[model samples]
Target: MKTKDKIMIFFLTIITFGTIWIYWNSKKKNNKKNELSRSEKISFDINDLILFLGDINNIQNVENTHKKVKIYIKDSNLVKTEEIQKLKGISSTLVSSEYVNIIVGNVAEFLKEELSRKMEK
Candidate 1:
């Protein structure tokens, strides 16, 4: 083969490899970004939930029952039912005249613990 042909093939191979490398790196970065955003969203939801329940002070008690977290509030009027319903992972909310009940699938225990810790602090 001519030297020109050999050089062309080499350059073509380099270009192909460069494209693959760039694609792979971009995919990895995108995966990381997606993971970060998901975690941030969960954290934001938990924090916002605390506020919607009328802060740590208003929460008199927290109970976890499988997929549900029942929060006893000092003043039911302070709870924001509309905002709580809009949160991402909240499966359902059962607001009574005196308390707040939220279902967050398997994260109920975690939610209860977070609320308890916040109250302690």
Candidate 2:
């Protein structure tokens, strides 16, 4: 009704809208980050990893830790270390003597199980 009351209401409305917009924008950005991370996880390919580990036949033993996959190969020279490090979900690669340890994020357990099964058959 009064001019002062109208001006106050307008400023309050703008502040409320601004707060809502900032909150919504932050939430949207977080969702997008989550989606990108999920996509990265899904991009992991066990077949490619196995191939880079010098194939199933070359592998002497496969072990999985919480966040790493330790693969013991008959001949470490047969492994393609560079290629294995480039695969999705692979954080890093470590080579020691006859074993190669791969940091495969959360998929290490799954990879170990798959490799074990392949070795059996």
Candidate 3:
């Protein structure tokens, strides 16, 4: 084979390998992200609760304004309201469609502030 043809083949091989490497690395990262998100679906801490409050999807609706944050879950059947109620001044109410709405008092403003600050960053 000609020198030019060999060099072209070598470049093509390198490009193909580079593309495959990048694709595999990105796939691994996506899996990790998925796992992390799944593990973070339900959090019982101050920080995670704040992040959950910032998410509009996790919230079904809001009634009465105050420091309380309301969270409605579709998997309420599997969730224990007692555990959720144990969080400081939180209260839980069972709603329709396997949904449970949890009310957490005296922390809405704090969560919003933290969410906004994080968004700016």
TM-score of each: 0.63, 0.63, 0.33
Global Cα lDDT for candidate 2: 0.81
Q: Give the number of colliding residue pairs in candidate 2.
A: 0
- Runs off by more than 4 Å, candidate 3: 1-44, 47-64, 91-95, 111-121
lDDT of 2 by residue, 1-121 (tens): 9999999999999999999999999988877644312112435677887788778898888897777889998888888989988887778999877899988776677778878998999
Encode model 3's per-residue lDDT on 1-121: one tens digit a residue. Answer: 9999999999999999999999999988877643211111223465544343443344444332353443444443444445555665556544445344455444454444444454454
Residue 72 local lDDT, model 1: 90
* lDDT accuracy of residue 105 in candidate 2: 70
- lDDT for each residue of candidate 1 in 1-121, tens digit (9 for 90 to 100): 9999999999999999999999999988877643211111243467798889888888888998877889998988888999999898887898876688998777777778888988899
TM-score of 3: 0.33
Q: lDDT for each of the candidates?
A: 0.82, 0.81, 0.50
